[model samples]
Target: MALLINHCPVRWHAIYHSHWTALQYDQQSITYQQLDQLLSALQRQLLTQINLTTPPSMVRLACIASNGIELLLMQLLCVRVGWLFCPLNPRFTATELSQRLAVLNTPYCWIENEQDADSLPTSSPQLQIDFELLLSNLHEQASSSIAVTTNISTSAITLTPLLIEPEQACNIIFTSGSSGFPKAIVHNYRNHFFSALGSQRLIPLASQDHNLLSLPLFHIGGYATVLRTVIAGACIHLTTYPLTVALLQQHRITHLSLVSTQLIRLLADPLFNAKQSAIKHVLLGGSAFSEEHLTALAARGFHYHLSYGSTEMASQIATSDNSSQLQVLPYREIKTHRGEIYITGETRFIGYFRDNAIHKIAAEEWVASGDLGTLKQHKLSIIGRKDRQFISGGENIQPEEIERVCLQYGRVKQAYICPTKDQQYGQRIALFVLFSDSTQFDLDCQQLKHYLGQKLISFKQPDHYLAWPLKLANNQALKVPKQVFLDSLSKQGLT
Candidate 1:
């Protein structure tokens, strides 16, 4: 591992020597020098394509793509130029894309290619930049660019001063929006810098470690991985989707991040024997984790970290090594008021993007994270989302509590409990269970009722039970929208 400064005014990538590997994709590997040249070329091509109405600080360089080298380079280019790099979910529908683009106000967007054009509106402007040609042209000029960069002293070279300032807006990532329209969360260079720094302290990464780009680039976890890898001078592997055990073994990945669902699927993989793998640390986030899965990982001698974070806080606010409670990482502060978590820190986002500009969040203001929790002895334990709590039969019900109990059931793989209208009780609990075995579809409701009868009190028990809607879960989004299940139940006159 090389000695590298974590935070500075200049581009973080420039901190590492030219020979260090920055990115890896199957047979190809790119060094810091090569990536720098690619980023410069991307910046030149992007400027010629965009038509901005605001200053560079306000300009949003919108892109729709999956986790890949191009998207990673685009974000680095945005940081270099002070543009707000907004990455939209490529799986978004035409309508979903249009709604978000209306808020973005950028004249044009960069799409993957012609095939992706249909997802955008007919009137929406788009630029299909030829990355292959851009890379080829760079190869022709690689010698000169490499020589020019290497000849200059590190202190003499710097990204645009005003544009790359720590306070300048750097990225706009949308919330998962599991039930409704997503909010555009804004983050500055400082937010990401400290986030990467804090994360490295908890989950140490070195130049020799290979960090898997497991999550989508549109996600905060994914984007944070890019910065963490660069700041630590580590290598990032851009692996293929439906990530298999074979792929993990082939890459010899040391560090990775995953949602609970992805972790469960990987554990279920026949080829996965956690004890034999090279994986050193796994950062688990997104949803409530299953104890059964954790126990399985423990039985297999796998190492994992449970983290709690949001889009508003860059990525990780707190993470746990082996304990149930999360330990607050460096550069972030957390407190509980009336059982709801409030956070104010360097990693706290700039604000929510709206009306073509960020509605800035003052540095002194402590943002209320809608999550309810308890802070004791400097450790945080999450209860559940305040918004997810509902009143049924005049008794308050926290869906996560019931969902956790359902997950404990051996046959249940994923459990989601949502509230639906009930004439007798105003609102009633509805359980959607994704079973581990397909044969569970024939499960008798009475048997589940008996099981719940033992685990839950009468009031917390679910009124209706249904098998998980497979079609609704078959999306690119990390978590399935809970509203989708409620709607399906509504169609069946169960609401």
Candidate 2:
């Protein structure tokens, strides 16, 4: 029983720090106290616009848009009023959106515009609300030039902005998994509370510091930033524009959240010097990364905090502050069972947002991380996903192991490997790779196969080779959809 650093009770929404800057989205900004007022305004607007005469105990709101001031407002409103805010990726197709909405049982879906509304199933159960109109009205009414939100009525409803405990559910985020099903992970106030606590203990952020939110809000990476900055009393730059060297310097961003791919791109840019960039911290979270790049950044005085966390864990279970080794943070315990990582802690996610309620977890209470890793001296190094393992002929094959070897080659930029059916071996390995942009390094199938052949055993080596596109989702961190990958293979006649 030790006191946690910066540990404090959960404040559903803090109305006190009104003058201090809380958010920096493009040219606009909002203070912590102003944020509280805006949420209240938006709550009144939700009350007037939506049908909630006999609202159920659990009310769910779905948002289809990129990150913005309005989306942040919706998120905070739900958090304060005990509503579940679900953000759907605008990249999802009509069928994808329809299927997910049905599962969510959502009565409200706030879309970016008319075009986004048209993209969703017109006949779906969820009522689509024009968020832009709401924002316009709010701006016209509010005196502060925080862009359109003052018009939002402050009329109190029966259910007020109640103080929610740490354990109460705050948000439900849908994450793409290997199971090929829409798994909505439920996170409570505590999950975020301690996650922020762990990160600050590792690398603290001050109120004057700014963290650039480059990840999508729908993903846990993006959601975690919101909670982290809020808890630290630090300002957040919520811009939709892609992170660039000029942009980072222009915004005077001290902290940033990025995946591995983004790191590589920054490394490639001659203007992005680790020592000169002035970025104090980079919260590295994602699937793939290289030690050479990490070492280079470290040598140049950059602090890349490698973290291993997921939607179920609310974010970072382990993080490396100054060193490359990821040390497990306090408020959580990390143990391995048969080489698989399992997390049990106050910050772990409550459960999957399932239908009805059998409120059961798999096996023991500890959440199975489904990741293979080595824990030594309380530090964890994630090797690969256990579910990513496949059998080739008779021997077990880990595609990530092969991909890791391929990444060592100077020309290889990105990689993806999966099992393709084979009668002789039961299953065979196939690879789709992207080589570094270079005229001299003209990588071909045979050349890559030859490079990997020396590094990997024949069984673990890929039997087939396909092209990897330069642009992938938000980075290599987010895996491509199963069907999308299959269709790409089919189109290339590689399947």
Best by TM-score: 1
Clashes of each: 0, 7
Tens digit of per-residue lDDT, candidate 1, span 347-382: 999898998778997898999988988887768888
lDDT of 2 by residue, 224-246 (tens): 88878877777889876777888
Error of 1 at 78 (Å): 0.7
Worst 10 residues of 2 by lDDT: 150-159
Q: Model 1: which ten-residue window has the lowest total lDDT?
A: 1-10
Show where candidate 1 strays beyond 4 Å.
1-16, 50-54, 122-124, 137-163, 442-447, 472-476
The best candidate by lDDT is: 1
Model 2: CA > 4 A from native: 1-16, 50-57, 122-162, 356-364, 438-450, 470-477, 492-494
Error of 2 at 235 (Å): 0.5
lDDT of each: 0.78, 0.72
